[model samples]
Target: MTGPVSTDRASDEALAELLMRWVPQQRWFAHKSSSAHLQRLERTPLDEGGVAQLVALTVRTGLGDEATSTVYAVPLTVRHAPDEALAGALVGHLPDVDGAEAWVYDGPHDPTFTRALLSLVAAEEGAGSPAFGVHGTSADGGLPVPAGASTKVLGGEQSNTSIVVSAPQGSAEAPLIAKVFRVLSAGDNPDVVVQTALAAAGCERVPRPAGWVDGTWTDPSGATAHGHVAHLTEFLAGSQDAWRVATAAVAAGRPFSEEAGELGAATAEVHAVLARALPTEPATPERLAALADGLRARVAWACTAVPQLHEVAEAATARVDAVRHVTGAPDLQRVHGDYHLGQVLRSAERGWVLLDFEGEPLRPLAERSVPDLALRDVAGMLRSFDYAASSGAASSGAGGEGAGAWAAACCEAFLAAYAAGTGVDPREPGSAAAALLAALELDKALYEVVYEVRNRPDWAHIPLGAVRRLTSPPG
Candidate 1:
């Protein structure tokens, strides 16, 4: 066992300098390209009992005349001895309260932070815990942590850190996966809202809700900001994401219509549950016009970001115009805004389990929380199918025609199943549903073009091809 390092916290000035250099490199930090200055506004400690301390820092970034602040919870672990496992995660050594220099590390990689997190969730208190002002609750009323539970942090997550807690032998509860949100927002996260609602309504299409961590803090301006910091859910062991499954099937030339159909059915089930659990509103002409405007704005922004979108700018506008002029529109309700194959899992026993309802990470929390056209989700899934086809073709060096055929088959089967489950045929031509679906599909493709250009330039052609297909006149 290693000796405990002294508990002297670094001064705010020294910490700010380190964070200024570190924040831009983090995957979850927004505004990376802008030249900005960071200032520490507040720091709250969630845990300081172990070899590490989990501290939530509200940092403000000022760029020119504009300024924005966000809360980030960083775990700073102090160690006197060199830890090989944490060598890569070292933040820097700081002077301890005991006048000894201690090695500090990023908390997520350390077992101390992970273990304390699980212990806190297992305690499951709504108020008055170590995380003062933060509320923690069990989604299923109570989540018992099995004795001798083992902990391991999962890898490759961009926005959040996830730790898996495996139950010991003969435990009643299943394994739990806890997601610690890196960038904090001042509102209830839709992931918690939607999953808890569905779980309460006995919706089996989602993983069982285990618990969540939330809190409120006053900003420097005296405005109170509420944040959902972390969430814990039942872990689905041995489940594979749909992207890997679909792309592999395409690469092997196997038909995926059956699985696609079942996935569509599962999506419809969640939609039905969300409609019942949350507020719903009919889609009026004014609302459709607003939605069209939103798409138009995105297209404009995308054109500015991705120069290739300039060719399709007029075509996208026309499609949005068609949606605005449509006579009747479907009802609007809360939806999975960023629905894609990767957001779903194919479970052997559960069929299909949906994950992540936080919507697009870039959108404001308010907009993401509002009810919207469910067809948006459908459009996103359709785009994913196209992406799978393109990716598989590239990987296997298959002809475009073969990949297109596979995508068409999946789209047809998935839409048919969704229609059957929801009593609305989005594939029906010349109908309001069809018009809305097409417009949303184009919007999603346009969004993808920008995202690909910015993040994965090589993959930009996939969505660019979609833009060309949607815009070109059908023979």
Candidate 2:
């Protein structure tokens, strides 16, 4: 009922004032448009030395009756031992109270926070467990942070926090990057299990794991918390994320034939590795039926949130109907989960190196972990290509002619490359695979529409166009 509480030494009055201003500044803060009512759920102390003591704050915000609470791992610094770099990254400034300035940690930066993050990653590698702390019985489980390993926050990453860890003195390589998992879920983290398995299977698309960290803690409500990825892997440097390169190619009006082809080949190889490493199961009618049901539910949800998704919803349903008749061995292999242009990297010599094995953001952890059609990942990449083209068009103010042409060219090149590399026929008829892919792409775009409308109303058009295109009759 009262304003949100802060578990820090700062008085409730100071914390409330800080929360009111701070909630609107965060990228992840859900209720930015309305006034926030804050309530503190929990806090953890980072240091016991009495100097540079940091606090992680979990706060709940409400707009009248509608409310949602999210845990934010914020680190605070006392005025006497202020961290300049940390202070500069503050999301919102607390009014100077009693000669102390309270600053919130910028989820994107903060070295002290990075150090704590590294502890989790080092814990994973040293302990021979998954980088994320998911405690499954699988071989890729339980990564623990090493003693005395430190971390430096990396500068890039638009959606997640990546921390680079310096191996303790007298180690083999320079520093390794440990990407801390932000969103928490109850199921096994795909990034840890799948990528680790791929690396073990000699898949060249992902960075090798040095270590991982994972564990469970009690929530404020006293429920047993499930394991989540704290951090994983020390990938090679000097590589560009595939999304940026693809967007650049589109914006410059350059044909992405070579890049798309390479991407396709790399994707095929990734699937092969996944198929080999993960346990397989026959694709029963029940599993396929369930997938269709899930897609239908997702489309229904999207239609409610974004009115523009109606066309996509109908088309997707039709496609699901067409695929319902085809019954083949449903191969359940570990997949990349959330594959896209951004989740990949282009290395100078090794070609496409995929990053972030985390799957679809909306799916539950168990669903993401369960092996499904490899074509699902392929569909995800195809959708990403559309997103890149649209994003570039929107940014450059390119008209329909330019954007449409570029999107078509990229799609063709990428498919050709992928087909050649994976030995899958892209043009084969009666396969029903292409229809399945289109349905998935439509589903992904619809999800994006909901997300963008809620978080960024301006960018909603990108997904809206995709929905319309998928629903329209072939000309």
Candidate No. with top TM-score:
1
The residue-by-residue lDDT of candidate 2 on 168-205, one tens digit each, is 77855545676655544554578877778887887778
Considering summed lDDT, which 10 consecutive residues are worst modelled in model 2?
Answer: 127-136
Off by over 4 Å in 2: 1-24, 30-72, 75-80, 90-110, 116-159, 165-172, 308-316, 393-399, 420-423, 451-465, 472-475
lDDT scores in order? 0.78, 0.62
lDDT of 1 by residue, 1-475 (tens): 1123232345555655666677678776777776646544344334543355555566666665787766676656656666888889888765542354567678777767666656556676433233324556666653565556777778877777888878877877788888888777788899889888888888988888777878665543557777797888888999998999999988888889999999889989999989999999988889988888888898898889987778888988888778888877778999989899999998899989998889997787888999999999999999999999989888888888999999999999999999998987887778898889988899888888888888899999888998888877644
Misplaced by over 4 Å in model 1 are 1-10, 47-50, 60-62, 65-67, 80-85, 97-100, 126-133, 141-143, 169-172, 219-222
**TM-scores of the models, in the given order?**
0.91, 0.77
**For candidate 2, what is the TM-score?**
0.77
Clashing pairs in model 1, backbone N/Cα/C closer than 3 A: none
Error of 1 at 355 (Å): 0.3
